[model samples]
Target: MIIHKSNNVTVFQSAVFQLNTTVVATEDLILVVDPGYLPYEIEQIRIYVDKIKDDRPIYLFFTHSDFDHIVGYGAFPDAKTIASEQFVTNNLKGSQLQAAINYDDEFYIVRPYQLEYPRIDFMIKEDGEQFQVGKTLFNFHYAFGHNHDGLIVTVESENLAIVGDYLSDIEFPFVYFSFEQYGRTLKTLKSIFEKNSERTLITSHGTVTSDQSQITKRISDSYEYLEFVKIQGSGEQFEQFMEEKKYIFSTIFRKRHQDNIMVYERECEHS
Candidate 1:
């Protein structure tokens, strides 16, 4: 369903993960960011795009290469795709992505189109890469930590930042990559927020907010969680940390949080 729409931007939230599929409708193009989740959800995005896209070119942007994020690639086959250069060149790219698709297919999951990895026609290799779509200017930044190949897009004219998976109010820092890199990424996001204080920050898994306090809190909370895990380890202290943050202690998330500690330990050992 459409979660938010104003002027030329529309954000659709998938029921499965609250994954956001953002549509930026400009006079010259329609930009779709991370269209994903169940089959019907993707179809709804396609239908909406078809409704608003009037012969203009459609562009697809994947915030990262996660299975859920790229599952809908085939839905917009003709759209020009964009991503970080690292995502385009990863050695495990095809196999890992296909594995994700296979996992979904194992559940008898049906999609409107055949599952396929996105063919990235445009790559953002440098920080502050700017592109113009109609009257809007989009600045793309390479964001690491949550994932090695994540991106944070700023739509200057619309005053919106389509952050891939970082700064989520509902999720703690899920560092799939380097914890050190994640810390750097958060700092980068904080800097971006400082400059574009007026822009609404839209995270993939949480509600959109322009409130500076909420944004600042999310950044500091994530950073503090990392520090707590690093110094405290996965012991009573870590458990207490989780409790203080009101983090629900689920077996799955607990395991994920534990893994974060493990990764940090391994990195420290090697360092």
Candidate 2:
């Protein structure tokens, strides 16, 4: 479906091909975010980049260290791959990267999505630190909670934010709370929403939201879901109950739970 392009920047997102892929072009460089699942999807992005950006030195950015977000990176060897310092430090090991070569285990499972470990450069981006590629300027901010160092990039000129798994339509497979830290991060994202209430948000999955109200609603609902799990059921029971919701979130939730039921137990203990 090539999920429809969102307004604001010269950004184009691919259809649901594992992890959603986004390409943001300026006058010169072509920056692609999360190169989907397969080589073919990356190839599609390559073709598009060639046609539009003249195949200029590509800048590939990873939102986190997850395999789905980087399965196809080897396809673009010449591109400069950038990621958060935390993700780069933890995931750059051959063992860590290869452990995810197949969806066999949790914490390090790499699905058979055409795996690749690209050369990564670490750039610790925080609020207001701008990443400039050609004419486009993307400012980074913390959208943690989903990942220890998750990032949300805002295209300054266009007023668009490229938020990765930070805001998933997929109900959190399990609550991810680092005690009060996760709570603070969620609050930070809410504040970002309130400040940029009129800007458009390009989520890692599903539809692009033009209204902050939608972001607010989704975050609130996800938190509610987490609370529901904490109060209503044990980790296993919450897993079964959430399956009943039947939204697209259910699929990811089920898969995650199937992979790591203990993660939920840990989260419950923390809460």
**The best candidate in terms of TM-score:** 1
Alpha-carbon lDDT of model 2: 0.62
What does candidate 1's lDDT look like per residue over 1-271, in tens digits? Answer: 8888888988999986788899998878899999977889889999989998989999999999887788889889889999999889876678768876787868888766677777899999898899877776889987888778998999887788899988887778888888998988888889999987898888998688889899999899998989877874676766776677767635666788888888888888999
RMSD score of candidate 2 (Å): 4.6
lDDT string for model 2 (172-252, tens) is: 523343424445556766777778787676777666777666788777866665565446454667656666544455555
**Model 1 misplaced stretches (Cα beyond 4 Å):** none
**Which residue ranges in model 2 land beyond 4 Å of their true spot?**
6-18, 91-96, 103-115, 125-128, 173-181, 232-252, 255-261, 264-271
Backbone clash count for every predicted candidate, in the order shown: 0, 3
RMSD of every candidate to native, in Å, equals 1.6, 4.6
Model 2's TM-score against the true structure:
0.78
Q: Give the worst 10-residue stretch by lDDT in candidate 1.
A: 245-254
Question: What's the true lDDT of residue 95 in model 1?
Answer: 76
